[model samples]
Target: MKRYKSILTVVAIAILGIAAGAGIKVYSILHTKSADILDAIESSIDSGSAQYAELKEQGRFNILIMGEDDVEGSRRSDTVLFATVDIDDKNMRILSLPRDTRVQIPGHGVQKLNHAFAYGGPDLLKATVEKYLGQPILYYVVIDYNSFPAVVDILGGVEINVEKRMRYVDRAGKLDINIQPGLQTMDGKTALHYVRFRKDALGDIGRVHRQQQFIKALLKKVYDPRILPKIPELTAQMMKLFKTDISPALAIQLAGFAQNELGRERIFFSTLHGQAATVNNLSYWIGDTKAANEFLNAPLEMLISGDVAENRNTNNFAGLSLSYSSAADENGNGKASGTEKKPGQVMKKDELLDLVRSMPESIAVLNGSGKAGLSGEIATRLQKIGIEVVMSANAKHFDYKSSNIVYPINAKPEVVETAKILGKLLDIPSSLIRSNNQAFYPSVIIGHDNQKLMSRIDKLIEISTQ
Candidate 1:
């Protein structure tokens, strides 16, 4: 239900529910007594130039809509969609970005896209999407679902065609979703159940499609002229759910659309095209950059600066990790409700070679066995398998019996995993993996066992590459 509430939050999200009447900012309906709620929405940040030349040049205003799954007090973004609000055409384009889409997060290794929200909140999420889509996102709305079901109830009941019967009970979420097949009128809870169900074959991909469908159904109810009399109630429901940086003028423009000739046809849907691959035995979707851009009709350069997101890569030896911080508002104002957790997950090399490539690691090889050129030879071998050789030199001593990988305490997730993989490849003892917090690189000191390690390294490189 937390995720469902989150979805309701994201449903305003992209839906055009009107703002409040009289003189008031759009998101000012909060009734919280807590100082924290007041702090979270008290953003005085100027979103953009009064108007953006990019919007005029590109013919669309990009808005990011994200919904968090507050399950177990974990705040990973459960739903992420880029809403391209085209002003000139008076249309909408929502591209549902998969939560698992492999993309680079600034200051972190390449991992799932949705982790951005969990780590840095909406600001980071906007930045990540802008980089991925190569566009400017001028506004966003994050809903807290405490009073969300009320919004659905106020709209009467949304008419939806059930694809099939759905029956699921989740104790953790305290959700009981059981509905028979065919056309139905779903109340707030039932509607939430319908949209949040994902036990079927297509999994998340299918759920994304269902979200788009639920949105259209919800919009149809919103467009009904009967809603005119209930404008006050509707406005309050919307205001309470949304948290955004949208300018008042843009909000008004969006509200004006309901009184215009806008229809469901104007809203198009898109999602990232990618394949599922295992990284460290964890499932992540390797996004198809070309396909994502093509679907959106906007190239990367058109949306992001320098036309790139640096942390993302399409190469072998690229390490991976999801950096989801504990529950907290991206803004410093909101505190996480849960206890502290570890920085990232431990990745294990999967048994299959079909696994996706990882982010790169800086590897420095040093000869310690009085071998004059062994370091350079080993460096060349490592490079063939995608581990970059940043430095190659002789060790201070020449009497070491075995080589080992050294990682720093402050090493990034990718570096740690890379060192472990390298250790395994070299048959380095677990005890030999030194935690050198001050080390600049993941250093490898070649010992007298170089010949034996090299023999294994050569075979490992051949297998890793092909």
Candidate 2:
């Protein structure tokens, strides 16, 4: 995905639609944007809302934008953040929730809050979040990571200063990536990695900060005059990659609103304050519920009354739900290695092709419910390696009844072997594996680790360009 900054910059350009007096369409954008609102109040804590809670009462508005990269029916929200823009104050505050933060997930009961989205999509995630913070969500925006590269590319590219020297390799999959610490110009792929890396000690929180910083860098790109001619291309790319309840007319109006009320200097960013804690024997990122409430409800009260403060939200276990499945580690013997493991392996294009060729029969690439793509990227890759690739529209949709990534059941040994190669190469245990067979009722799943690989790849590409 594009750096959050560039994406937001494009979003800001699109917001012009919302700002314009675009009539009902504009109103629809206001209505459909799903904000993660507090669903139920906690009995132990005093009930209140976000910094901008007051703004709502005063006729101001706030909206939450969430991005998820679900492949199958499995839903796992990738980016969750609250965007509070005070029209009156002309101040916008962005508070991001760490995906791994522990919290009470609505309806499904408390677990890692990110699972709320995986189990029920955005609506349930919003409800769970609202309940967590004791506030009402106003609106929402959801999209996938695939849309990211095009969006970033459309804007030319984003500029961000690197903080550290970064490098990693995935040999089995024939993958290697690196990034230098310094002022750097990142294309779509590199920008995507900038926002996705969270493997460091800081965890998700660190990732969120990187996201915010990149937004500033991306905004500079948006404000550049050079991007004006690319408007049509950018809009088209966004439509292809994005699916939102926000109306087309409203989008134009938002663009207008941004041009008028929103300003770079006026925006503020923050997150909820808390530390990881264990609740009911389940590990959770515990915050001073009172302080959390104060931080949230207080600023929100101002926003709704028309005021705005700051923002702020993993684990692996198996046999619980498809949403929480961990990658398989250890040897094929099914032993628990207790080491941090990646869910699947990566293989070189050539290596993967050989594995497929060795299979007894030609396999078909199937969409959910057994559909197929005529000339898809996967098929092209296969063909390059001398394997006959067939696109199957009749491919069974097994694993991802709820999410997006579909994992085949009893995956071909060759596929597993290929992934193992990738796992060994990347140094992360390979837990994810897919097959061309239309069988194996697998759950749809997209691993968080893929984001890391994507970043590593972008870094490598960046170095090559240099």
Candidate 3:
């Protein structure tokens, strides 16, 4: 009970803890020097209206949360979380969508999820997330990290169990982070250092765990009664630190309902099931792109009241294990009247990998093995995923024994994993996967033992559901 699904929300709430409680804590601000913060809270309460009456009449809603750094320009959301809170069941489920996950933006083809934020702000990011999850999100809250250091310092400091020694220096960030491994208390500045230190092998993903740790520590402090009298001071520093659509009226109204109607609520946290892969030599997290609504996103009940129990995920909130249904949709109904698999071998549909879209931007393929038409044959299969083979010519000398990828530039911005995934589909070996930035795409050299790989793909594609 009383769990925070994401550190962004926890920080926003803790920084402005008392304001979130509506005016119930307004009286406690009388003794503090934070009169300015009290004024802002009073103003919000005064300007608020009962817009959540209908939501209260029912019992659940979903929120889309975006968390970003406090930097000035070229801002991209660092965090994207989808939360579903069902007051009726006293349960909350949260799904954290990684910023680097591949998604199809409205005007942009498949790109990193965070690009939506940079391209169109939260609204576009929301739309992109909705498409990925197979649903829509109406509520949102954005946490600004600029004033976060102040909040931690105001509460004296927060404690964290540093898993390992972190030492990273970034002159541009004016960041020189060096914290030893141990259980210790970190001041505001040091706490920022701890959260932003993402130098482990895990990369950005590792930073997520650090953020979670900080939230746990911050939550412990929020629960401490000593912060009660100083709520106004914290709220003052935080009132302008966040952006949300939550009206003061709805916040207070929901607060009362959450405390009374929903007692000892249960909260669940989950993230997308995927792995970090190099796409075109660039790093990205990729997963099954065709996951259905039930498996990928929150149910409609998450954003509205009077939702059916089925949509609340009451029986299936244990974790992120997803089971596929060949014939059923999220509502336990057929996908469509004529959508069932036709009972036949659909010709021209025999491919192990479906090219997501026929993107023709910056991808290439070549035949390093001199067998005539070998390059064209492989390009056909690659096209299924919507990849138009940019270069399908033979290598300078066609005396190679295997196929591999090459990146002419540094691997930092190359799409490396695309070749690996294609290799799996094409039954290419990992040893054949090279990382020389010599070619734009992968070079496929036909080997004498390539027949076995084709047989495997043929078997997979020929299998019929009917």
Candidate 4:
């Protein structure tokens, strides 16, 4: 019995198809004598339906990709990914779902996410994912593992830096993986083995990471000039390997968009937020619904701009509310003397300095104002007040309206308190200080509204130093 798990290859095939179309377009443009190639490109483009145009006009859509495996006589999805493609913004965000994640499978009660495929194939899996994320899936692609290697071989292999030596043998499954570490180009079979080897401590999570890495590498290979001439061949091969609702014309249109507009910086990847738990003696990854939904509903700006930390922790602040009655409330306790301070009220300068000095964690400062060097400047001011600045960089895009202090959902009370105090010190509204499960650390996103606070922060720094 061979166990198949070539999940990322499904995505690679879709991307390859798009890349092929893009390459053909480029090739046709350069070689006018290739009348046959040019005609195919024209025909694909002309075949676009009104629905496809409407979807493009809608600006964004979700796609679900599943890698199916036949075990004994039942089919299960070994890997599931939900993708949100923002057309107008030229950004693509993908969230990988662990196969063992516990979910409500329609007509089957509660079961592993992968079990949905065994129950009803792609349609049920799509519905399960949509219900899980609270969003509609517009398209789906299902690819068998057997066809994955051929696509990689077609591309002449992909370059990947294997982190460690991998050796595994499963005679029962007819699987034998042996790969050396470091940078190497992998052909179809080697790449499949590379992604499927999951005997390490991280298990499936590690495999997911490897798959993501492979996807990126595959994308790079797809754009390689050497692959341009092989576009037609690759496209035909991919069409035969995958089952998808996307028509040839729509795929070509998207491929053109990806090649022409989507850059490496615009692509983002994340895993479904969850925790490993044992239920009824069965190990399962319990999905964090609130945190996952928040992540999915998060603005595209934030997703594209912020780094997706590998070790994500969930904090559910769903119904919690905070009210500050006085300066003492900044200490994480609501009890305080004197007149009640409103949510956005500024704390005394001395108090703000004390809070900054007492912060328990370092913070990453991001310039969401679109201004160069803004984060570094703020970081300097923060360091002057004894706050450790761990990272300083520009947010991917800079259209933020106001500054925000963000802490992880499961952040320590002191950390949350630090964010609130920092917010007051910087004159940011209390509402702007909130929880974000994706935050790697307590962070400050300096928006356009806070760009003018340089002088104010300078004065505070000077006074604190004195």
Candidate 5:
């Protein structure tokens, strides 16, 4: 039997449910004593935007339903779908960002937007996305694969209209997720893969359509009155598996209107229209800037509240570590809750530091003893372009090796390309590289656009360089 890989690590899909945990329970118990938490939250930050509050007080309320792909070990959002709910108007908007969609990477320059997560994790991803949209991302939600099964079980089952016969093998074991392409119900595992399968030649766009379909179905499951009492359990599960800036009180308040808002029939779903293009000799999913700006604004301005608006201007961002779910340690035990068991779990200390020292803020070169003076020559070449260098011996353990750099969850394509160059320079064979990891770069070689894109990724880099 062919060994199965952990599907959770690949898709990072999240299920819709309640958010709760020990922290939540303890807080909730204490909250009964006084209105301290709620009061604090209100005073600390504005939950509702002044504009949104004005509209709601005038009987207009809007909510942006965001679905984030928080795979195990990595909290960075993978798939970002905006669901806009206008309570007073009874309309909704669903916008999907193709994971491969190319966008500005803040300080780095221009690159695939998904890399924002791998480079700096969630904070960078959120910032880059928020800036691109030109609106506040009011409420944020995160969910992962492991918690998905429990959520489906909690709700008895979620009905999904499966598109094709899903016969793929995953770490959850073999999934015979076969169903006709029509109205149908799905259990946890089946539904999970149903929303994640991107085998079609269209690549990530195929995944986008599947995600849109699941959201429509999930809203239906959430609204049925029969699932009302299960809210506490769902919330608890959410706390264990998800994180967001959305506070407990606000979350509860939002739940109150969930059914009425989500039950509407008129919902809009569209992926940003764009064509694949190779700029500076590197591939990118480029779209019309004007169209993207227009498409994102109407809903973003409406649903995103005030606190998030204020955060949009700040440099505060959160960090997340991602590894395969089945990754094992030296003793063959699983690495962590979210890590997958995979061989050659590269030591981040030495290799990561090597890359950092060589490139610092930009790309770098690495050399093993076998390569002799090659590292020096490459370092000299990089120096001509104002890049730095770190020798194998002088390099600290903090340096990431080709593997870790290449497979970083949510990492940018440029970083991956950097790894490929080091690999080729050191004469490392392709077979030695593990392609099954979450962040594998198809090739290690670098292109001029890759470097330019990396430069645009992080705004902080520009400030530091200046």
Candidate 6:
């Protein structure tokens, strides 16, 4: 699996080079001979004009970053990223589109997103993505995978914690990856392997998460004080690695704005949520277009405030039979006891049972309620209902207020639907059910609210089974 790194290096180098150039301007004024480099930098900086300001005032500008590879004599984009730069707000939102995402090409019928590049290179891919996203892309950066390693090497490697043992061998592609789990400094080759390892259950979604993590780590390295003095040389070397439509001046201005105004907290990263599917015997990722549009068009505050997650949950569960059954709600009441079911909101007992039976992914029940053996107990209860419980363990922390059913962003539609049914079965509120691309599988995080559910588990099982 081929993966691409984020465009943080491009922005980071621009910011560092501009900062260094600004500092050198004063010294250059005193020494005529030293002014040549400063003059060149100043000329580039002068490229910022009224149009750039107008775009900035409009709140955000979008950039498309693509990484391409040659396979079987055809060029295809392995990575597609949409970067929304909120200049006024001093933040950026990067959404990665999986290569296998099903999309329509201009002259071609519906095909994999990567095929747009193979069909007409970056131009077609850009137009296809813009059409798919319903947003205009103002600039584009295309990086060839061959140059990726050189860029990483220029940064002196990045430190990252390998979450698991990754081992893959592709003799045809001359690729061999064998990386163990632990915190280690990864050089160019190793970093490439780290981002490209997607053989695990999560597949491309897993790779996307690692790419985001790697970007964050790389950004930290770029901002290190020691790197300040080497900006000019690093920028010169790195600039040669990628092809972009962004002007040197505009790149500097944008990066400077980001570096000066944004903090680590302000930068947000997300993947275009979707599900894996097979159409006509060929595997493809079906993107959630509605959710993607809402996310792209949402207000900066909402995006930063974590409202996007809630919005996604709403969109994913819309019109789905993931609601409470006629028997109970979170308060544990039925219509007979004066707890009237909302019109068209009740899921039949049979439907819930069928959903559990058809669930494809095993869930990891985690105890976040600070209760001992709660995960095991819940796992057992889930298994009783025909749901598989693959792992039961303590959560990273134990202060959760309400139980949550967490599924990966790239989970199959059926998996998500089944997760919702599972959530309803456990009396978990829809608000707590979320999609996390970082997760390896659909999981149940048992919270303090689940204590009540524990007492009702037997009754719940009885109701579901009946």
Which candidate number has the best lDDT?
A: 4
How do the candidates rank by lDDT, highest first? Answer: 4, 6, 1, 3, 2, 5
> Relative to the true structure, how large is the alpha-carbon lDDT of every model?
0.58, 0.47, 0.53, 0.65, 0.43, 0.64
RMSD, one per candidate, in order: 21.7, 26.8, 23.0, 15.4, 25.2, 19.2
lDDT value for candidate 5? 0.43
Task: Tell me model 3's lDDT, rounded to 2 decimals.
Answer: 0.53
After TM-score superposition, what is the CA distance of residue 122 in candidate 1 from its true location, in Å? 0.8
Candidate 1 wrongly placed segments (more than 4 Å): 1-53, 298-466
TM-score per candidate: 0.54, 0.52, 0.52, 0.61, 0.48, 0.58
Q: Candidate 2 — which residues are off by over 4 angstroms? A: 1-56, 70-74, 168-177, 278-283, 288-466
Residues 283-393, candidate 6: write the lDDT tens digits: 888887776665566544344323333333422222221111111111111111112212223456787677677776677888878988889998898788678888998
TM-score of 2: 0.52
Candidate 5 ranges with C-alpha deviation above 4 Å: 1-76, 83-92, 167-183, 260-262, 280-283, 292-466
Clashes of 1: 10
Per-residue lDDT tens digits for candidate 5, residues 70-105, read 555454445765444443333345566766667788
Clashes of 3: 25
Model 6: what TM-score?
0.58
Model 2: per-residue Cα lDDT over 1-466, one tens digit each: 1112222222544322322223324444433321211111122123364424444343244455677764454557767876654443334556566676677775666678678778877677777777776666655567677678777877777777777865656566343447678887888888777787665656666666667666667665665555666665765676666555444444444455555444453444444456656667766555444544443333221322111222322111121100100012101111112223334444455554444445444444333322233224334443444545444343332222211222243456654454443333233322223322233332222222334533433433333334
User: Regarding lDDT, does 3 or 4 come out ahead?
Assistant: 4
Candidate 4, which ten residues in sequence have the lowest lDDT sum?
A: 319-328
Q: What RMSD does model 6 have?
A: 19.2
Tens digits of per-residue lDDT for model 1 on 1-466? 0111211232442344332222234433322222222132233333354226555445455678876567777777768888766543344556777788878887676868888888888878878878777767766777555555777898887877777888888987898889898888888888777767877765666666566667767766765556656666766677767667664443443544433423444455555655668998878877666655543553211121111122223211112111111111121111111222222222333521322245347778988788778999999987776677899988656755666666664568888877876765566654455544334677887877688778767766666755
